[model samples]
Target: MTEISKISLRNLQKRFGEKVVLNGVDLDIAPGDSMVVIGSSGTGKSVMLKCILGLLRPDGGTIQLDGNDIGTLRQRERNALLRHVGMLFQGGALFDSLPVWENVSFGLLGAGGISRRDAKDHAIETLAKVELDAPTADLYPAELSGGMQKRVGLARAIAASPDIIFFDEPTTGLDPITADVINNLILERVQELGATTLTITHDMASVGKIASRVAMLHDGKIIWSGNASDIDRSDNPYLNQFIHGEAIGPMRPDVSTTMPKETY
Candidate 1:
C-alpha cells in the first residue's frame, strides 16, 4: 500500500511586499520520517516553516495535515490540529522567569490543559527522556549550559507526545561534541514517539546526523531532494556549493552574504 503523507504542502507562496520568500514550493513528509531542509541563509527555509506552522499565512497554495486542508480550518480547529505539532526554536526560547519544568510544560499546560501537578510530573519525565535529571527541572533556563538549554528545548518539543516535530537549526551555537549529543538525543526521542520531523538547518553535521532524507531549498523553492547518503552524488550546482561550502559557486554569495561557517 502507498503510504499517505503526514504533512503536505502544494504550490506554497509567500512574499514580503516586494521580496518573495517562498514561491510555488511543494513538499511532503511521510510518517515517522526525518526530512531536513538545507539551504544558504535567506533561502526561504524559515518562511516555508512559518507557513506550515500558521505563524504566517501563505499568500497562495495549500497545507494539508493528514490529507485535510489546513488553510480552511477555523481558529478552534487550528488549535486542535496544532496540538499534534511541536517546535524547537532556533534559540532555546525558554522563559527566564519560569523554572525549567514550567518552561518544558508550557504547551502541556495550555493545550493539553492538564493540572500543574500533572504537568510537572510529565515535565520531569520528559526531561529524563533528554537525559536531564529531575532536580534539573527545578532550575531556571539561565542556569543551564547552552547544551543543557537545547536538551530542555528538545524535552519541551516532545513533552506533549506530538506526532509531528519541527527543529529549527537544531545544532546551531554549540561545541561539536555538545551538538552531536543533541542530535543523538533528538533521534532517540523522535523514534520513541514515532513522530515525523522536519528540520531546517545550514549545519551539514546536523543534516547527516538527523536526516533520513534531505532537501535543498534555493531561490525560494526546493531545488533538490534525496536520501541523505546521496547528497554528495548530486550534480546540482546549488547543492554542491552549499554542501562543500565553496565561496565561488553559482549562487555567487558576496562577502556580506556568505553562509555562516559550520561552527560544530
Candidate 2:
C-alpha cells in the first residue's frame, strides 16, 4: 500500500513446520537505495529474502512492490512483475557446463528472439562492466578462479539491466583484497544502473563499501537499522556484538538458530 518503497515487507512471517524462520519481519527499501541486511546465519536472512522473491511463501503478512501486494497478483501477473528483478547467488551458481558468456546472458537468452551471437556479444559487454576481459567469456566456470567466477555472476545479474537486484553474500570466499574489488564493482554497477538493491551479507567490509543503509536481522526480526555510517556508533548491544565479532552479547550461540560463524 506504500509506493514510497521499491520493496516493502510488513509483519512477514514464515515457518517450516515446527520451526519459525521469520517472525513478524518488517522492512522497507526505497527506490535506487542499496540496502544491505546483515545477521549471523539462521537468523532468517535468507528466508526473508526468499519470501520477498516469492521463492518461498510466507504464512502471514504482506510483500509489496511499488505499493501493490504481490500475494494479490495472479501467477502470470506475478511472473511478469518478477521479470524486472535480478539475483546473484552466494556461490555464483553458474552452470558448470555452460560457457561464461552463456551464463552471463542466461536470462537475456531465455526471453527469446536474441541470436546466440548477439547474446554472446551482450554477455561480453556486461563482463567488461565487471572488469572481466572478453577472453574470459570462452571459459567455463571451473576454469576461472573464485574471484573471476564472482565477477561473471555479477555480470549475469546486471546483464538484464533490471531495476531491482538481490545479492546473496556477494563477497563470500576470497582474499580480502579480492573481496574489496568485488565490493567496489558492485557499488559501481548499482550506481551506474541506479537500481534498488537488497544485499544479504555478514561481511562488514562489503557492507561498508556497498550499503547506503544497513539493517540487522536477529531472532527472525529486524533488531537494528540505520545509515551505514552509523553502524559503528550505534549503542545497540546486538549490533556491537556483531560488527565487532564478539563472542558474547545479547545474541547467544544456539546450534538451531545460527548460520556458520562469521568473522567479518
Candidate 3:
C-alpha cells in the first residue's frame, strides 16, 4: 500500500519581477521520511524551501501539511501550524545576545507554560542529545567553535520535538570530519523523534548520510528523484554532473557576470 504524504507541494510557482525562481515545482514528503533536495547554488532550492515554510508567499501552487492547504490558513491557524515546525538555518543563525541555554529553549520559553528554570533544564537535556556538554550551554554562540554552534542549532531545532524539521545547509562551512559528525547527529536526533525532515544541500556526503530519499531540483522543478542508494547509479545527466562535481555537463552555470576579468 502507498503511504500518505505528510507534506505536499504541487505546481509551486514563484517569481521575482521577470526572473522565475520556482516554476511549477512538485514534491511529496511522507511522514517520518528524511527527504533531501539537492541542486547547485542559485537553482531555487532555498526559494522552494521558503515557500513551503511560508517565509515567502508563493505566486502560485498549493502547500499542504497533513492534507490541509497552508495558504488558506488564517493568521491564527498559520501560527498554530508553525508551532509544529522547526528550522535549523544555514550559518547556525543563533542569537548572539542570548546565552546558549536560552537559545536552545527559545521556542519553549516563548510558549509560556514552563518556567525559565525548567526551560533551562530542558535545554540542557536537549543539548546532551546532540552530544553537547553541559558547560557549553553557558557559553555564548561567539565563544563556541563552528561545530559547537551547529550542535547548539540542532539542539534548538529538536528542543520541542517538532513533527516537521527543516535543515538549511546543515553543514555549509564545516570541515569534512565535523560535517560528518553533524550528519550523524542529525540522523540520530531525527530517528529518535520520528520527525519528518526536509533538507536542502549540495553536500553529497550529507545527502548520503541523512537522506532516505533524494530529489534533484533543476530549472525550478524537480527533474528526478529516487531512493538514496540509487543516487550513485542514476544515469540522468544532471544527477551525474552534480554528484560527481563535473564542470563539463549539461548544467552551464552563469559565470559571464560573476567571473573576474583576466589581468596581466
Task: Write model 1 residue lDDT over 150-173, tens digit each, in one string.
Answer: 999999889889999999999999
Q: In order, what lDDT does every prediction score?
A: 0.89, 0.90, 0.91
Q: Please name the candidate that would achieve the greatest lDDT relative to the true structure.
A: 3
What would the TM-scores of all predictions be? Answer: 0.93, 0.94, 0.94
Between candidates 2 and 3, the lDDT winner:
3
List the pairs of residues colliding in candidate 3: none
Worst 10-residue lDDT window, candidate 1: 255-264
Decreasing lDDT order of the candidates: 3, 2, 1
**Global fold similarity of model 1 (TM-score):** 0.93
TM-score-based ranking? 3, 2, 1
Q: What lDDT would candidate 2 get against the real structure?
A: 0.90
Scored against the true structure, residue 56 in model 2 reaches a CA lDDT of 78
Using TM-score, give the best candidate's number.
3
Clashes of each: 0, 1, 0
Residue ranges of candidate 1 with Cα displaced over 4 Å: 1-3, 254-264
lDDT of 3 at 89: 91
